[model samples]
Target chain A: MKILLIEDELELATSVLDFLKSEHYLVELASDFPTAYEKAIVYEYDCLIVDINLPGGGTGLDVIRALKKLHPESAVIIISARNGVEDRIVGLDLGADDYLTKPFHLSELNARLKALLRRRHFGGSSDIVFHEIKIKPAERNVYIKENLLDLTPKEYDLLLYFLSNQHHVLRRESIAEHLLGDDADQMDDFNFIYSHIKNLRKKLIDRGCLDYVKAVYGIGYKFTDKK
Target chain B: MKLLHQTQRLFFRGVLPVFIAAGIVSFFTLRWVFDHETDEKLLGVQAEIESYVRINDTLPTFFQTVFDRWYAEPMPTGSMTNLKAYTFSDTMLFNKFENEIEPFRQLRFPVKMRGQIWMVSALTSTVEHHDLVLILAVLLVTMFGLLLLVMLWVNRIVSRQVWQPFFETLEKMRRFRLADHALLTLPPSSVEEIQELNTTLENLAYQVRQDYQTVKKFTENASHELQTPLAIIQGKVEILLQNDTLSETQAQQINIIGQSTRRMVRLNQSLLLLSKIENNQFLERKPVALKPLLEKRLVWLEDFIAEKKLELETILVEISLEINPFLAETLMTNLLTNAVKHNIQGGFLRVILNENYLIVENSAALPEASVKDLTARFARGNPHSEGVGLGLAMVVEICEQQGFGLEISFEQGIWRVQLRFRK
Candidate 1:
């Protein structure tokens, strides 16, 4: 997938650039609004990760407005340090698909980008199939072979999150946030993460599926098909 | 005490005594002057009798009437020497006609009549003087009473006028809210002291607001500035996590750093939210269905609640409140999360929503004997919990900004928090 990253902060921009590039996407960097605007109008891209604050004579919102007019079907995501209500509403109302606040996990960002691309390209008709595990986005169902995986709503979401970002380490904090937006404020943070994941893993194993989950020591759970 | 009452107290303790004392002194001075004049009149009578008796011997014809009584008596052995000068005495005399003793002013004087020293005693009825003094006393008391009343009334009016601006300032201060946008209203005052008071008060209010804004802006800027670096750190750690050749210790260190960075982000966001609430930034209002919002929030805590097997009870009433929908959802979610998070194992968590209140009650493992400040910042029952320790503090800020009431109580291992919705 082709993606455009418009950010002013050099270090953050580099980290995002490297992360997205490592994800095997054609990621282009535009550190200023003018370059972002020029490249966005001149090139074709699958997704645009725009920061609300940008230097060079224009804000990220302006880039979104200019490029969105040219390509209304483009997947646009707004990342801002200004996470106020009005900022989020303004970005979303301007046809941005999602609004991610600053200091976000790049894994979460990648999942959002992939989801946005999938929806934009196939119109959500694509059934995400991973070997024996299958997730139908339209029907909101997961299947292991012929039998439906009887998973709770939380388990279902956790599985989908794991499937999308397979082989990537997912932090407990990020997982909690992804599951519960602001209510991810858990008393025992890892307990809720552990409870849901344990149940999900048990359900998957009982469905006669090989365990594709690995605990990376003290880091977080990882989904990999290796051994 | 009120200013008026304080001044009136001054009149009671200080001015009123001086008034009473001056009245007494004046009454005594008037009596002395009257008595002196009467004594002089008696001396003239004595002299007149002496001259008459000397010029035409054989006791001058004198009629004894009730109004005037006089007598002549030869000097008794020692009495003549005792009468050196004219003497006056306040004595009682009996009158045959009246058949009652009447007060009299008597004067005795020694006189040489026809070459003989005689004691001439003269008496006059003192009923008139007594009547005059009684009337004077009555009049004086009436005048002083009227003066005191008038003084009190005048003092009341004068104090009310003198202190009018002061009380006005007090009332304006009482009604002033820091969250309001308007400056403290200090109306013009003519009194120099009052005007000075107003100036000082206005300055204090302005300074307080300025400091408040400075701190608020500082908090917001700090939070915003930290966001980029925090994001960079987390991003770098995530990138490092994908390294295949990294050792176990290196991976753990990277993961720990990423977790701490994520925590810092949550902390920053929470602080930003707190300052925003204090700033009254959420102003949009709408009628929100609260039950559904709470039900939706509770679903997020469902896993933990079930993991501990804590019984959950939610009794909600169909009530609507006019508030910012975002704030409303946040308030409900925070309250629910706090209740579920702190509940003990096998303990019950109950949520009851009334028309104007929402109460969350849960059983605690270690019940505090006294009331604790759960709403204070970073006040967590468990320090090691994953919470940012700002949940209840944010709830308190939202409630305070929105004019809602918050009450937290712990009784018999039951920790209860009630949010009283403003009517």
Candidate 2:
């Protein structure tokens, strides 16, 4: 998949680029409005991550409008520091697929991009299979080798999120944000995340599946099919 | 007092004494003039009678016909010495037409007729004391009525026209809100005092609005600048945590950094939200069914409540509130979060909703904290607690902007928050 990231902040853009590259997606960068607008019109991208506040005079909304006219099939996600509901509504109404507030985790952004891509490219498929584990997105049900696995709603969501971004290192903060959204900011510790991960790991092991979930040292969990 | 009414009262206070004094002075002055004229007429009649007696050497028969009453008595011979005194006195006489005794002003004079000293007394006309009083009373009443009517007419015109601009400025000031960005406009006035007042008020309002915008801009820029760096720090920490050579202690220390970064981000977001709310950015409003919304939020919060092991009870009535839906949801979420966060393990939570209010009560683990401190920014019952402390503060801001009443109290080891909505 090819994606374009339009952001003025260099550190945030680098982190997002690194995370998406590790997921094996080809990504392009545009730091200002004019370049972003030019690139968006010239080349076709499967997805576009546009920041509303560009370094130049123009805004990302303008770019989204132009890009939508140029490539109607491209999916756009708006990343803005402005958390106002009106801005979100305006972005979504202007044909943007999703809106994420600033200071967000890279993993959460990846998860959103994955969901958007799945819907856009896969024609809204419900079933996703990775080796022995299978998931029904519509029913939120998971099974292993024809045996249904019992998982809480949150656990089911976490499993699906990890499966979508397999082999990518997921930070605890990103996992927390993906699960709790804005509420994760209030948590002072990651003990609950640890517990949830423990239970999910034990459940998968009990179902005779390989240990696909791995801890990347001090960082967080990663789901992979690689040996 | 209202400005118009106050002015009217002052005018009455000043005019009332002058009106009474004028009435008294005019009454007495008129009475004295009328009395002097009557005396002059009586003297003229005396002169004509005396002239006739001197010409004919006898009293005229016209004296008895012209006067209402008359008497002439001669003093004894050799006892009267220069007996030619003239005097006037009031007397009572019987009136045959009205069959009553009426007052009269009488004049007496001594006239010489054929070398005899004759005492002559004549009644000129009836002059009742009450007649003078009645005339004075009628004249004073008519003057008073005219004065009152003129004063009322002037007051109405002055209040409606002369003070119209003042009143308009007053109304504008009443409706002025700093967030609305609509400056007060006062019509130009011919009056110097009102003009000065309007100019000063306009300057004051302009200064205030400028200051408010400055503060709002500063907050927005500060939040935006701070957020990017916070994100960078958090990102670096996450990257560092991925190193396999790191010790457990290193990981724990890095986790602390991550946790504090999260807290800072939340604080920044809350402050930004407060500034936005103060700036009146959330203006769109719709009628929201609050009960269903609350129920939905509760379902989302079920995990949080379950983790706390708090027993939940809800009495949600169908209440419709007119407010911005985003703010309404945030308010409810904050209230529920506070209730669960502050409650003790295995505690009880009751959410009661009625037509006018929503009440959330929870059993507290520690001693009851001050309601003022609890609702303030960064306030927490337990210092070690993970709460960012902006929940209640945001709730309070939302309540104030939305014209809702928020009351917090702690009693019997229970923390209760009540939100009263306008009917």
Candidate 3:
């Protein structure tokens, strides 16, 4: 899938670009408003990630407006530091699909992006299957070979998040943020994440499924079909 | 006191003494004029009798009957040396109607008739003591009545008209609120002092509102600007944590960095919320039921409470409050989180909701000093706890903005927070 990221902050843009690239998606960057406007008008993409406050004296809402007019089929998500409720309403009203506040976890962003794409391009399918593992997104139920695996709500969410970014290394902080959002900030320690991951892995391995969950040495965990 | 009543008080205070003094002085002056006129008439009568004696060379027969007394006696040799001597004295005379003695004013003088030295005495009609007192009393009463009428006019009509502008300005001030953004428009006045006061107050209110807006804007801009960079730092740390070649110790250190970055994000968000509340941004209000909201929050916090192995008891009465819905939610979340976060291991947490108030109590470690400090920003009872310390401060702010009463106290090793809703 092709994704266009319009952001003025080079460092944040680079981090986002690298993360998305590691997921094996084709990503392009537009560092200013005019460039973003030019590129958005010139080509069509599967998804558009736009920041509200763009450089060159224009807003991302204007970009979304222009893009919707030119390519009405494109999906748009607004990422902004201005987390005012009014801004969120305005963005959604302007035909954008989602709004994400800044200082958010990249993993959470990735999850939301996948959910949006799944709804837009995949006919709103709720079932996700990977070899022996099957997930019904609507019911939040997971199964291996037609046998149900009981999982806590948090564990199920964590597993789905891991499956979306199969090979990318998932940091503990990112996992915690995906699970708890801002509430994770109140936790004095990140040790609870380790237990949740361990339980999820055990539940899968006991269900006659290959263990795709891998520990990235001193960092965190990863799920991949690769050896 | 009300401004109008205060003015009346001062007016009466000043006018009452002057009225009494003037009445007394005028009463005495009238009495002196009456006595002086009576003396002049008696002297005229004596002079006329002496001239008649000189012109006709015989006493007038009508003089003795008309006057109280017309007596001519041989003057003593020493008294005759001075041709004329006049004297006035008060004397008593019998009244035939009432058959009682009455006071009189008598005049005595020396006269010469046909070169014969003679003494003449005359008494005017008796001037009753009671009549003199009654006249003075009437004069005093009349003066007092006039003064009362003037005072009443000034207090009720004149002063009210004069102070109308001042009272109007006072009323406007009483209704003014900084959050309403309504500028004070004082009524136009011709009085210089009232106009000056209104101008000064208007300028002061304008300056205060300007300063408040500037500060609010600064807080919003600063928070907005800091968010992106903080996001960048947090993202970089997350990326670094994914490196497989990093040592365990280095990974631990990076994990600490990530945790602190998350804390900073929470702190920044809390600060932004506080500023928004101070700016009165949450103006929408509705009646919210407390029982359901508290129950929902408790379910959300079940994990935290279980983690601490704390016993939880909730006694929620059916009560509804008028408040901003979002603020009410925030208040409940913060209070419940504080109760669970600060409680001791294996301790008890109690929540009680009633018609007038909501109380949250929890078993805690012995307080260092006082619970009053807990309501202030960054005042944490346990320094090692992970809370950002803005929770209770936000609760206090919401309470003040909503006109709810808040009190925090610690007793018997339990910390209790009570919020009283205005009826």
Best by TM-score: 1
Ranking by DockQ: 1, 3, 2
Candidate 3 chain B weakest lDDT stretch, 10 residues: B62-71
B1-423: candidate 1 lDDT, tens digit per residue: 988999999887887778789778878877787777788888888878877877887577788788788887877555555566777899987877889888889998876766677778899887777678778977997888898889899999999999999999999999887766689979899999999999999999999998889988999999989988898898889888888789989999888898777778878888988888888888889999899988887776777788778998989998999998989988887888778777888889998998989999998866322345657787767766667778888888888878898898888888888888973
lDDT (CA) per prediction: 0.84, 0.83, 0.83
> Which runs in model 2 stand beyond 4 Å of their true positions?
A1-8, A12-100, A106-149, A157-175, A182-227, B48-68, B72-85, B90-133, B181-207, B242-254, B274-292, B315-328, B342-423
TM-score of chain A of each: 0.95, 0.90, 0.88
The TM-score ranking, best first, is: 1, 3, 2
With a 3 Å backbone cut-off (N, CA, C), the pairs that clash in candidate 2 are none
**lDDT winner:** 1
Quick one: how many clashes does candidate 2 have? 0
Residue B225, candidate 2: how far off, in angstroms? 2.5
User: Residue A4, candidate 3: how far off, in angstroms?
Assistant: 3.5
- Which lDDT tens digits does candidate 2 get at residues B298-390? 876666677778899999899788899888988888888778767787999999999989999999876435789878888888887876788
Give the C-alpha miss distance for residue B338 in model 3, angstroms. 4.2
After superposition, the stretches of candidate 1 with alpha carbons farther than 4 Å from their true spots are: A185-188, B76-83, B96-98, B365-372
Q: Per-residue lDDT of A1-227 in model 2, one digit per residue for the tens?
A: 99999999898888888778877899999999999999999999999999998977799999999999989899999998887777899999999999988777777788889888888988767578999999877567899997999999789889988998777667777887788766555444455677788889999999999999998666678898775
Relative to the unseen true structure, what is the C-alpha lDDT of residue B160 in candidate 3, on a scale of 0 to 100? 82
Taking chain B only, the TM-score of every model is 0.93, 0.80, 0.83
